[model samples]
Target: MREDLTEQLSPAQIIERAEMSKAFRDVFALAGGKRVLFWMLEQCAIYTDAYTGENNSTNYALGLQSAGRKLIAKLDEIDPQFYPELLLAMKEIREADKAAAKSLAEKLEPEDDADIA
Candidate 1:
């Protein structure tokens, strides 16, 4: 099954694929997809840290929050009516993640010496 999926395409098929890819890129360029991709990458970093028990997820989330604010500022400069709601949504998400991180940190903290003794 894996071999079937890994099979190489013919030259014509490859050309068709390349053309389709170019078309997709053109559409994404017109739709501000780079901003969306950056947002997704930041989100992935934050969640990856959380799931892997890394200590830096909070920092990553904070960086994302900063980026979101910058993006909103840029949007405001370009057009005030363009997706202001998305900025608010991203802010809410960052706040929720911060709360969750705080809760997790509390749970993972070492016990006091008195309790251990």
Candidate 2:
């Protein structure tokens, strides 16, 4: 076990820990269909609730809670900045979406001028 979490660990630690998780076994049993998506969403909701204020329960979701912790635990071995790549892409896409929505909203003038006055 890596004693110092602040210190960057090697991939070996991640592989070792992942091998010990129920989620990994479930991953291997995957038929690569809808269950994978459902399992991921189930686990994600547990993990997400750990941070998000709404629906603030974690463990009530069953295998998902520990499954999420095990997954986050592996991330300690990876480079500190690696996870943000996906977040950056998501942010960029959201900004573009908002801009497009604003343009569309501006184009939709009021149907009745009398309602405005």
Give the C-alpha lDDT of model 1.
0.57
lDDT of 1 by residue, 7-75 (tens): 677778768756755654553344345446347546645324333355586666667666656655554
Q: List residue ranges in candidate 1 displaced over 4 A.
A: 1-82
Name the runs in model 2 displaced over 4 angstroms: 1-43, 51-57, 61-82, 111-117
Q: For every model shown, what is its TM-score relative to the native structure?
A: 0.34, 0.36
- lDDT per residue (tens digit) for residues 1-113 in model 2: 45675256568876665565545445434444224433554556643545433353433454466765454444334434323432354455567879999999988966777
Clashes of each: 0, 0
- Whole-model lDDT, candidate 2? 0.51
What do the candidate models score in CA lDDT, each in turn?
0.57, 0.51
Q: When superposed on Cα atoms, how far off is each prediction in RMSD?
A: 16.4, 10.4
Which of the numbered candidates is closest to the native, going by highest lDDT?
Answer: 1
